[model samples]
Target: MANTSVQTEPGTRRPGVLQAVLLLAGSCMPVLGSVLLTPILPQLSAEFGGAPGGEILVPMVVAIPALMIALFAPFAGQIVDRLGRKKLLIIAMFAYTLVGIAPAFLDTLPAILATRVGVGITEAAIMTVCTTLIVDYWHEPERRAKYLGLQTIVTTLAATAFIAIGGAAGAAGWRTPFWIYLAAAIIAVPMIFLLWEPNKADPTDSHARAPKVPIPWRRIAMPLIVGLFGGFTFYVLVIEASYLLVDAGVAPTDTPTIGGIAALASLATAAGGFTFTRIAKVGVNRILPVAFALQAVGMLIIWFVGGVPGVAVGAIVGGAGSGLLLPSMLTWAVGSTRFEERGRVTGLWTAAFFFGQFLTPIIMGAITAAVGSLPVAVGVVGIACAVAAILLGFGLRKSNMAPAEEVTATV
Candidate 1:
């Protein structure tokens, strides 16, 4: 059931357009920082003198920041709720900008890894706070949906652009792309000037604040489960794409081209998200199952189809499904929570999302190592999604939560 006390104004009634843009920019920086590093892993490994399990190190570098984000998201939320979103966002962006540039100067693998962890921590702060602020600004379900889609679109587009840029820079020198983070500081400067504090007064300002209601774990459990599955699917698609292409006989030189093809599939996700507002009239409940089904089918296609085109098709299908599912799930999850607890609930949601992302590489790598082939490994992920879809189907059927329309109507 949706929490009745969290006053949800119509999302169309949001306060500031500039603030929204700035928040979106802040949210997208970490994504850009992460994806831009994808093509540079081999170069970094070679430069460092191959350590044990060095081949996995690059992935670890990419995934670990997400792992830390998952681990610390709750704390990040508390800090935001207590300290205010704008202040925390500024701190995080500054940290992100600095840490992003650290690798250019640091030569050791450990030093780079340490900096990545710092970057992840800052990312958690920015992502959690930004999400809370989005909820604060946009109250109408449909409009909120559109903004969320826009957020996904911007991050996807930025990541795609940065991947190409990173690869080019990596070809020149491995450390060059880290300098890209400097742009985040530049992007955040205007955001800091424009973004307003949330209307909800900071609770820390007064000791006489009313006693808080306990968060309802039972209400949020189903959405959290869905988020976890979504994250897992996302990571599986991202981590396995390159290997899936390589196994199908594509040369290493062709990996970036293939990866770009897969990454381009994210555009479908953006489109799907945009399409979701229209689809909601038919019912999000009806749409969600179909979305998960598409994801399952996409994963199945990747498992069965091996070449570059196959990978591209699979990515498009799965990415579209992911694009659809994420906004729907987030809307459901946030709608279910009280306003006072939105930050914490969002934190948990972020944690679940990153946890699934964090687990994908390790699990898929283990499966690939054990089975000795990419197809078998991807097949395992397919099976996992199939199982998750079945569970989601059951959850949807049993769920008694308010319809999104009702939620919007109240707003």
Candidate 2:
């Protein structure tokens, strides 16, 4: 609010490391929101067992944020476009910290789940603004790819850390992990000084008034639609991996051990995320096929091999694929739109991505009910992801919709 315009001409000068680090830091909040509560879900259920439908309702607290993001991200995007990125981000970050910590003192499962909705609302704005700012700050496609890849890497690593932290905190008590949400406030303070609205208008200049271009509905819609499936593919294993391990014979009480296995998969994800810039050279069309193939082979391995070793190996392979998939879909989604509509497109992409995540459990549950096994359901999803990737890759290349040059060029 002090002065939105920090630069006379945007995308001319390189952003400092501090800015990139700050954006990357903010990007972790949504990822943190998604995974931090996971390690504590069992404790939450036990504590609230007296409540009706506590089993389902307690897990909803784990899942409600994704639903909220899916429902409200587009609106948050609109706000970002109209009100300005930095302002919404600052406000959302503060709100996220407040709402995120509220559950620490809540008495009822319903009350806690309601607070989770607040967490999701703030996360919607935070994710949309943070991603838009990254694109706004970096002009070159290669640099954007690098930062987004790094974003994935940081997110994956942060998730691994948070899972361990959540487990450790949960060991102390169910509510202790909620304290970590205060990390958002720590992030917001630096952001107040370091983060700025990119490409702000100069009110003194009449020529600064720019003509609006109609949003390319098809171009923007394609990646988002594809991202829905990408999100589904990425989350299937993350959501079901523990169940897969248990179904294979691991003890249900072994949460810490399961978390350790997940941390290893997170390493694999970080490996793939770290290579995103190099992979971007191949174009998303080519990358998509390879990513899904890894997932397909890995899922098939789990289905046929059976047991903890299989689950662990399959997860690492699948995690690598998911890591690549996120950045590829993101790059594809935002590549077509320029400054004017990137926020909205990014918001829609966030909505699509999280919506896919939100749908994963329900879809997998239906598949499990029909098939009578969670592993088979997971394998079915893997096969579907593989088929889609291959078919889409062929069409994307043949149609030349995003030719190599077009994919690499900054909008």
Candidate 3:
């Protein structure tokens, strides 16, 4: 169901290693924005603690970028489909580098927070275009699955590294970590030379003369719904692993132990990403349930079995599920659109996924307070995953997640 439009390849070149490498690396910019500032949140709060609304605004530095992606990516998608992909992506990446690094030099808390908003808006464009181009470049199902799955693996691994980088950089000063934003500019260099606009139609082609159609919102609705859930489960460990460790008796001051276990869990997520293509041939219907199930099993382990060992083992189990969860959702969401609407499709899916991520902590916080125990709250989410897995695996037919059912409607 991937776009099969006959593209006039950029000169004689086809998308190869350098293209894949750049796109995958580009995909990580959003991950850097999301997790890189997390380890330094406490430090930021202390520095800006005296400012009005500092308590709420300081944490927004990490969360607001994602919230922006959720709110604005659909508009970014509109721009990509209307103008050009590579042009917008290159501009956003460069903008991201400048805006991303500006916070490091700003003195006031509100000004710093304003820069973070700028970071999110640029991220909305960068993340959407990077993903849309991946689908554009790789037309083969196997090739598309491989690279899409790699997006998850690479970004998941990057999250772990960025957390470590943020923590290490924070030691110098809270603002020191913002210098890390310079990497976006570095990644943008080859992008100008190596990347091409994938769907530019020839001026005289008959197909080009045909009017375009709207996004297949009806077809994608199910996939995006499932994607929202996948995104929610995807971050359970990244957000809650520390709390799980603490509940299991690890000291709040034991940074080393906490970080070690989190790293191990991240590896488990990467392993799931690594194995995704091997199992991707089974299709999204089968993959969805298993991904959610593995996470459910891991969370259940942590719920029933108390102690450091339980937390460690459960995190590994849940982490692996998260690794597989993302690519499956992406593949599901994007398979039905054509070249003209690919950007819009990818953008909607991105919005759904990140909106789910933005909602995770807020929803989890409510659940935890309602239950009055972290373990019980986690147990409730685990149960929901179990139910979802069963329903998705058996309740839905293969055609329900049909990548093969490509929409051919044209104006």
> How displaced is residue 87 in candidate 1, in Å?
0.3
Residue-level lDDT of model 3, residues 224-337, one tens digit each, is: 888787777776666677667767886544544665677777778878887776677767777788999999999898889968998889989999998888878788887545
TM-score, predicted candidate 1 vs. hidden true structure: 0.88
Summed over model 3, clashes come to 0
* Candidate 3 Cα RMSD after full superposition onto the native fold (Å): 4.9
lDDT value for model 3: 0.78
1 or 3, greater by TM-score: 1
> How would you encode candidate 1's per-residue C-alpha lDDT over 142-176 as one tens digit per residue?
55666665676677666667776776666667788
Runs with alpha carbons beyond 4 Å of true place in candidate 2:
1-14, 45-51, 200-210, 406-411
lDDT of each prediction vs. the true structure? Answer: 0.72, 0.79, 0.78
Against the true structure, whose lDDT is highest? Answer: 2
Worst 10 residues of 3 by lDDT: 402-411
lDDT of 2 by residue, 180-270 (tens): 9999999999899887665546332222245555556788777888888887778777767766777788665566776778778877887
- Model 1 misplaced stretches (Cα beyond 4 Å): 1-14, 45-49, 201-211, 253-259, 406-411
> Would you list the rank order by TM-score, best first?
2, 1, 3
| Descending-lDDT candidate ranking | 2, 3, 1
Superposed model 3: Cα runs more than 4 Å off: 1-12, 42-59, 106-110, 202-211, 246-257, 403-411
Model 2 TM-score on a 0 to 1 scale: 0.91
